[model samples]
Target: MILIVVGVIMIVTSLVSTVTTNYKKLQLQPTTESPGRDDWHHFSTGSYKLFPTEVNYEAAKNGCRNANARLVTEGIRNKVTRKSIMDEMILPAFNANKLGEGYGVWIGLDDLEVINKWKWIDGIASTNDNTAWAPSEPNNGSERCGMLHKLLKWLINDEYCLVANAYVCEIAKSK
Candidate 1:
């Protein structure tokens, strides 16, 4: 009888664990589709445009300027906006470049002007708490440009400024 009880308890524990794991998984999963559209993708919670084309940091800045936007940065200050950009723009761009295209995309964060002091192209100062960086990243002293790492859940990393990569553009909501 004791052995039977132990077996029953084990079954119960296994069932509970499975249920908990599934629940957690559902909570973590994000919607595969993006939120809104403005000829360019837009997240209703945040106003910004995503340009998935490949370009170096300087060219990207110029492109955004031409389009009346800036490279994505200000709108990504919070988790919701950041996740939207990742799922809607960054992920798709990364997937499309699977054929030996590029490593990552620019996101306006860089420490080129000063060591360890990352700032967005728009002059917004970046703080460690405000952004996500891949493990042991920003390690290369010479590669002072910042990018959204495709394999690392869109985490930020520093890379060579000269290397061309896809970039995201941010258009502020017109008041």
Candidate 2:
């Protein structure tokens, strides 16, 4: 009797795990089938249209800084900007890479060097405080890089800073 109960519990647990993972992966709408031209691969940061390069979090941030810019952070919760990101940033990267290609991109926010405190490379915190994951995000589990997960909605991760992947760089607008 005990053995049978244990087996049934295990089966149920496995099924639940599988269901949750699948649900997360299905959150995003599908990416574009045909990747357009290079110019169409990215979105605008203020007045400057920025492009992404394959690199880790730290390097990408540094690279952007060298050019007096910063990494792209999707802290915007507006409809227009969201649509552009869906069309430009997300779709292009999906088509150009693997299913979850380009896991590491320097966004405008991270708590790698710090903990719980996430700010953009530009030193500005997200004005929209609602752009957070489901309560207990950032896992902070030895992970030091941040990426917008393919599924899991606003779920973000922190992995090693040196881990290279595709990243979005942001340049400041001329006032």
Worst 10 residues of 2 by lDDT: 40-49
- Model 1: lowest-lDDT 10 consecutive positions: 93-102
lDDT of 2 by residue, 115-135 (tens): 666665555664435344534
TM-score of each: 0.69, 0.56
* Clashing pairs counted in every model: 0, 9
Q: Which candidate number would show the highest TM-score if scored against the true structure?
A: 1
lDDT of 1 by residue, 1-175 (tens): 9999999999999999999999999989996554444567666544566565667888888887787678777656667778887777666655676313667778778887888788877787887787678888878888888887767666788888888787777765631
Q: Model 2's lDDT to the true fold?
A: 0.55
